[model samples]
Target: MRSIIRILGVARDLWPTYAAIVVASLAVAGTGLLTPFIVKAATDHVVDLTQGNASGIATVVWLAAALLAADLANTVLTNVSGYLGDTMAARLRATLSSRYYAKLLALPQRYYDHELTGTVINRLSRSITSVTGFVNMFANSFFQMILTVVAVLAITAYYSWPLAVLLAVIYPVFLWLTTITSARWQVLEAEKNQDLDVAGGRFAEVIGQIRVVKSFVQERRELEVFDDRYRRTVRTTRTQSRYWHTMDATRRGALNVIFFGIFAIIFVQTARGVFTIGVMVLLIQLVTMARQPVFMMSMVVDSGQRAIAGSRDWFAVMAELGERDELPAPVPPTGRATSAPVEVAFDHVSFGYGDDDAVLRDVSFTIRPGERVALVGESGGGKSTLVSLLLRLYSPDQGQIRIDGTDVASLPLEELRGGIGVVFQEAALFSGTIRENIAYGAPDATPEAVVEAARSAGAHEFVSRIPAGYDAEIGERGLKLSGGQKQRIAVARAMLKGAPVLVLDEATSALDSRSERLVQAGLDRLMAGRTTLIIAHRLSTISSVDRIITLRDGRVDEIGTPDELAASGGIYAELLALQASATTRDLKRLRQFDIRV
Candidate 1:
């Protein structure tokens, strides 16, 4: 009931439409009361005509006309109710979608790590559809049923109190049946929802790794796994259906048996002269009208339970997410023209996705206004974590990160992020036109400026080769493009933003030799006169930087010029020797392959 009320809270803004629906519903249910009156008039007129009375004929015709008019009004109300339901569903979808996107963007990285992309999609689409059904049918139908019962009881009292009491007794039995059925279904639905989440997660995983699945020749195995999941879903759905069907059969049987017994009692009363023919006919009409409302009310109970469960899940997500407590408002950065771009300093900063073990530990570094520094480290050594910290993607637990001597956390997040451009390791691109993807960082950028940025990043050549040129559509995640092509497009996007600080996290890690050279040249031009921080795995990328910072176990193990660090017998020296050895081994393999061919 609380869940229903919470969902009804959405109607506060649409009360006018809701009020119309309510009034129409009451007016429709009120017509049930007139059913007995119409039957009474017709029955009494027949009795009068047998005594040669023509006066009652006119009254009979009037009552018949009244019944027809009431039926017409009921039909109109039904139409109005349906229209209201549709509008309500549409409104809810819009509200939820807006909130879902906002919440998703604000949620911490830890939240996403445990959630599947497909599950999110399912909740937004299918789960919301179920909620809409629960709201429209369960709420309105149940209210109308209550109104009908009250109206019928009042009319039945004037005809026969004993009959009304008998019918009222059946209400508790129906309520008990519905209560049991709904509780059972609620548990089933919760289980079904969890199963759905697992299924969705599996589908998303398979799609994302289709290439790996094919390469490993495990396509058949993956399909078998998916088939098993589908079978489980089918089994659960069948079980639920069987339970619902049984409940339906039981309710219908009970209503039939009880109504038959009531009719028998009323007939005996009429035959014994305890009630008139008019009164008996009126009793039947009253009882008949009550049947539909009762059945509808039971259905409402069932749907309401499911809806509440679904709503609780959504609210749990909302409560867990809460809201990001960011600054309400903040001043923009004014350090661009202050002799230095902005001195970004990290003081003993440490962070991890979760727990006490930090990914970047006691990591202290500083970049002057226009300094170009390179972060070089082995895998899992925390170079990427540093870039993430600088972008404020995650907050450090131990120390502070300052930009221009102001704590990064103190600045408005939007303003802080707006001053920096980062190209991630994966080089993610959306499904859109080349031009749009490049201009994503700066939405209002002019077409000429977008073209210039693309040219500067060396992406314009390949983009021009596409059928639509700049307007060419990129497939999902830019899967249609080569690795180098995607990286170049990402670079173009960052270049177009033209922020004062730039962080490149292995932006060219996936590209081939020729593409890497081309991208490296573009990056060189982009890095000039800017505070640039580079995270690279390849020794070639770090060789030209002014300073190399080596990370080990989330801390800066060494920091010096590239040659100085290479000469020192430390972590940097070992890394250089390893890279040299790997290069030699690669060349040896290539020569051997040539001789064999």
Candidate 2:
């Protein structure tokens, strides 16, 4: 009940609409009660027809007309309430979805480190569907059931104490039995839902990565895993179903016997001249009315329990900390700030992922304004983590990172991220028009700005060759483009951002030689006059960086100009010697970053 009330609070502005729905449901209940009494009155009037009263015919006719009117009202109000319920449920779904998405966007990157993308998405689907479905049911049927139950109990008790006592006893006992089943049932249901959620999550992931699955020929293995999860659910369902039905059968069986005994009492009393036929008829009708809700009571409890579980999951995510800039909501970037490059400093930073050994221990370095430095290290030596920390993807455990001597923690996330443009090994493009992808955060970017950025990144030629030019729809992640094309578009996007600080994480490492040259040219253009941090392994890519910061076993092993580190025989010289043994390309690409390796 508390969870349901809390859910209602989520859309509290809709309270007036809910109140109107409740009124309509109440009227439906009122009509249901009116018809039963009308039947009783008509039956008694028929009894009077057999006597000396000639007015009984008209009385019966009027009673029948009144019963029809009550039924008509019941139909009309039910339709109106149902329509309201559907619309309210839709509004709630939209409200929940948009808020959930906003929270997801604002969450720290670390939250995604241990969670699957599909699993997070699956949570939203499950939570919204369960909550909205329950809301619809509550407005359409559950409210009416409560009203009907209370009205019938009151009406039944007034005329015949014995039938009322039997009905009252049966109602509570049935309710008690339902409660017991409901408790255990919900516990089992929670477990089943976990299985279902995991299955759903995996299903989406598999579809997204179908190419990987098929290339590895692990289709059979995935199918077996998916099959095994569903098979477990089937076993759980059998146990859950058997228990619920057995209990429900027992409850209904008891109600039926008690109702039969009440029926026997009414017939015996009426035949003995202790009651009238009209009274017996009314008692039967009222009892029948009560039975329907009593039977449906389990379903209501079940739906409520499901909703409670769903709401719990939804609120759990909602309860997590969104990005804490320690300031008011971030103002939007008006336009690119003046590109006066700022010095970036990492001061004695120490950190790791949750419960893991420290990946970076007491590491510190500084990049001067307008200097292009390259970070070089063995794989998993915290090179990527270093850049990530600079991006404020995760906070450092032991030190502050400052840009131009101001602690990054003091800056708004919008400002901190907005000032830095990054291009990674994989060009993570979204499904949208080429122009939209290029101008992602800059909604006000004009077509000319977009084209200029594209031309600067060397994407304009390919984009122009396409039928739709900038209007072309790039499939998910730019799957329609070749590797080089995607990287160029990514460069164009970064160029469009016009950020004063840039980070390049092996931006051309994944491309072929031809593609690498094209992307390298674009990256060179993007890196000019900016404080750039480059993370890469390719000799041609980093040979021109003004300095090299090398890491060994998670500590700063060397930080010097390439020639100085070459003699120092530090990590840089060692990597240079090793990479020098590999394939060679034109020396011209190194001119942009400039190292003497």
Candidate 3:
């Protein structure tokens, strides 16, 4: 009940439409009740015709006309009420969808990592449909049922108060039964929804990783997993359906008995001459009309229960705390001054994921403006975690990170992020044209600037060679392009952003020799005059960096110039020696296959 009220509160702006629907519903009910009275009057006029009264024919014609008019009013009002109900439902859906989308954007990255995409999508879809169903049922069925009962009871009382009193007593009993049964069914329905969510999650996971499944030849295994989940969903749905069917049957039987009782009471009254034949017919029709609302109660209850369940899920997501950025609103940039290199400092920063062991502990470092530094460490040495902290993707557990002598947390999120550009090992591209992807960070970038950035990144030649040049559509995640092409496009995008700080995470680690050379040249151009941090496995890429920071066990083990580190006989020197040995082995293998031309 609280969930229903809260859901309605979301559509408060559409109260006028709801009001109109209520008025129309009452009008529709009023006309329907008048219909039986007109019928009763017409029947009386027919009976009077046996006395040879000519005026009875005219009276019957007038009564017939009134009945037709009442039917016409009922039809028109019913349609109007339906239209209004639909309008309110549409408004409610729009409000909820917008709110849900905003909530998703505001949620932290950690939330997404643990939540299944299919489960979230399914809940959102179901919530929208269920809320709409609830609104429609409330207006057309619930409200109409109330108005219909009241109108029927008032007219029946005019004929026979005792019969009206009896119906009033029976109505509450049916309502109570429906309410209790619906509450129990809701629990089962919720269980069924949970099963469906699990099935949907598995289906989405399998489809998204279809290539991996095929490569591993695990099609049969995946099919079996999906079948198991689907069977569970089916079993739960069947159980809920059976319960609903039994309840519906019981409700109908009870209503049928009450209907017979009302008919019998009218029959006895007429036999005793306590009522005329017209009154008897009228009472019977009214009694029959009253049964319709009671029958409709079951459907209303079912829809209401489903809606409540869906709204609970919807509100649960909305209630979660969103990502908090303490930064203030951004101040407009002053010309050319905003493009200066950014000096970054980490002041004894410490971080951990949950209560697990710290990923970074009391780490302190600084890079002067325009200095190029390389972070070298084995996997799980907290290299990426440091970068993520700098990007404010996750905050440090202790200490402050400052940029250009100002705490990063003091700057607006848009301002801080807008000042830095990144190129990851895997170039993440959306489904769009090459131009759109390049200008994503700077949507309003001029065509000339985009082309210039591409030219600098060494992408213009290849881009021009394509049929549509920069306008060409790149398939999902730019899968249509080769590794080198995707990386160059990513570089071009970063260049177009023209941020003061650049972070390259193993940018050329996966490319062939020819592709790596081309990508390296683009990286050189991109890193020019910018404060750059490079994370790479290949010593060749970082040999000329201003300094090297080697990490061990979440702490900085050594920091020095490449040559300085090599002469010190430390971790950096050992890594260089290992690479040299690998290179010597490769040359020896080449000599084994040599042939003079």
Candidate 4:
């Protein structure tokens, strides 16, 4: 009961629609009662009368005409109210969808890591549909049942108040059944919904990484896992369906038997002359009418339970969302004369994803404006983690990160992110034309500026070679282009944004020697007057940077120019020697390949 009220609270803004639906439902019930009364009158006068008098026949005709009029009115009212309810539900769905999307965008990146994308998508789809459908149907059913029950009681009382009182005897039993079945169904629905989430998550995971599965020859293993999950889902649905079917059958069958007994008793009284023919006919019709209202009670309860299960999921998402603080009024970009170009700084920052296992411990670094700094380290050495912090994808557990002395946390997040550009290791690109992809963040950039940026990023030659040139459509994630081509386009996009600071995460590591030269030339031009942080595994990529910082165990191991670090005999020196050895092996392999040919 408490949960139902809470769900209805969400509908406070749509109560006018609810009220209109109520009115139409009452009209339907009133019409149903009139229909039976018309039959009662027609039967008593024409069929039970002596000599079939013309006056009686005319009276029966009038009753039939009245029934037709009532039916028309009921139809119109129902159509109007049904339309209003549908419209209100649509609006509510829109509001909920907008809130869900906004919450996703506002959350920190860590939230995404902990949750599955498919689970979130499935919840948004199913819960919204369930909640809205339940509200609409439940409202109509409740109002119609109330009016029907009242009319039945009035007619039954006219026959014999004692029997009407006897009919009331079954109310407690029906109510008890409604409560128990509803609770059971609610629990079952919740279980089924969770199973769906799991199944969807698994399916999405496998599909997204199908190449990995195939390459490793794990297709049979993955299929077996999926089949197990699917079988569990089917079993759960079967159990729920069985419970619902048994409950519905028992409730409906018991009510019909009780109403039949009432009708038989009334017929006995009519034969004995204790009840008039007209009254007996009305009693029979009203007893039949009682069946629908009683059955409706069960449906209303069932629908309510299903809705509560769905709304609970919906509200969980709403409650768990993080609040985004409103942005301050826009301020024009400052730091002209006194303001330096993009200077990146991290101040005594200690941070972790969730626990005390810090990824960056007391990390402090400052890159002077217009300097190119390279962050190099083994995988999981906190190099990428540090870049994520700079991007404000996650805030530090302690201390602060600043851009040009302004703490990034204090600035509007949009403005802060807009001031810097990054090219990820994977070179993430959406499906779109080359021109559109290059100006993704800068939608208003002119075509000439876009072409110029592409030229500066060494992408113009290859793009021009394509059939559509700059207008060529790249498939999803730029799968249509080579890995090097995608990276070059990513660089061109960053250059087009013209942000003062640039962060490149293994930007050129995937390219061949020729493509690397072209992309390197583009990077040099883009980094000329901007502060740049480069994360690279290849030794050659970072040699030209102003400084190289080697990371070990979440802290800086060495920071110096390339020559200085090479001679320091620290972690940097060892890494350089290992890479040089690998390169020598690769060259020898090429020679062997030529001799074999």
Highest TM-score scorer: 2
What tens digits encode model 2's per-residue C-alpha lDDT throughout 289-392?
98888888777777887888899889988888978623335434334445788899999999899899999999999999989898877677898898899988
Backbone clashes for every candidate come to 1, 5, 0, 0
lDDT of 4 by residue, 163-279 (tens): 787677666689887787777777778888888887787778888778789999999998888787778878887998798888878987897788777877898899999887777
lDDT tens per residue, model 1, 1-597: 796677668447766766766776676677656667777878878887886865646777887899898788778877877788678777877776666666677776667768888787766665666677887775467667788787777777766787788788888888888788877787877887777777787788889878999999998998888787778878887988789879988987988898888899889989998878888888778788788777777667777776777777766666665226432243333222332366789999978877657788788888887787888665677777777777777778889999889998887677788788889888889998898899887777789988888887788888888899999888888888988899999998888877788898867877777777777787877777778888765667777888888777677888898889989986667666655666766545423212110
Model 1 scores a C-alpha lDDT of: 0.76
Clash pairs (backbone) in predicted model 4:
none
**Model 1, position 381: C-alpha lDDT score:** 70
How does model 3 fare in lDDT?
Answer: 0.81
Rank by TM-score (best first): 2, 3, 1, 4
Please list the C-alpha lDDT of all candidates, in the order they appear: 0.76, 0.82, 0.81, 0.77
Q: Give the local distance difference test score of model 2.
A: 0.82
TM, every model: 0.90, 0.94, 0.91, 0.88
Badly placed stretches (over 4 Å) of model 3 are 50-58, 324-338, 583-597
Pick by lDDT: 2 or 4, better one: 2
C-alpha RMSD (angstroms) for model 4: 4.5
Q: Let me know the TM-score candidate 3 reaches against the reference structure.
A: 0.91
Instruction: Count clashing residue pairs in model 4.
Output: 0
**lDDT winner:** 2
Cα displacement (angstroms), candidate 4, residue 389, comes to 1.3
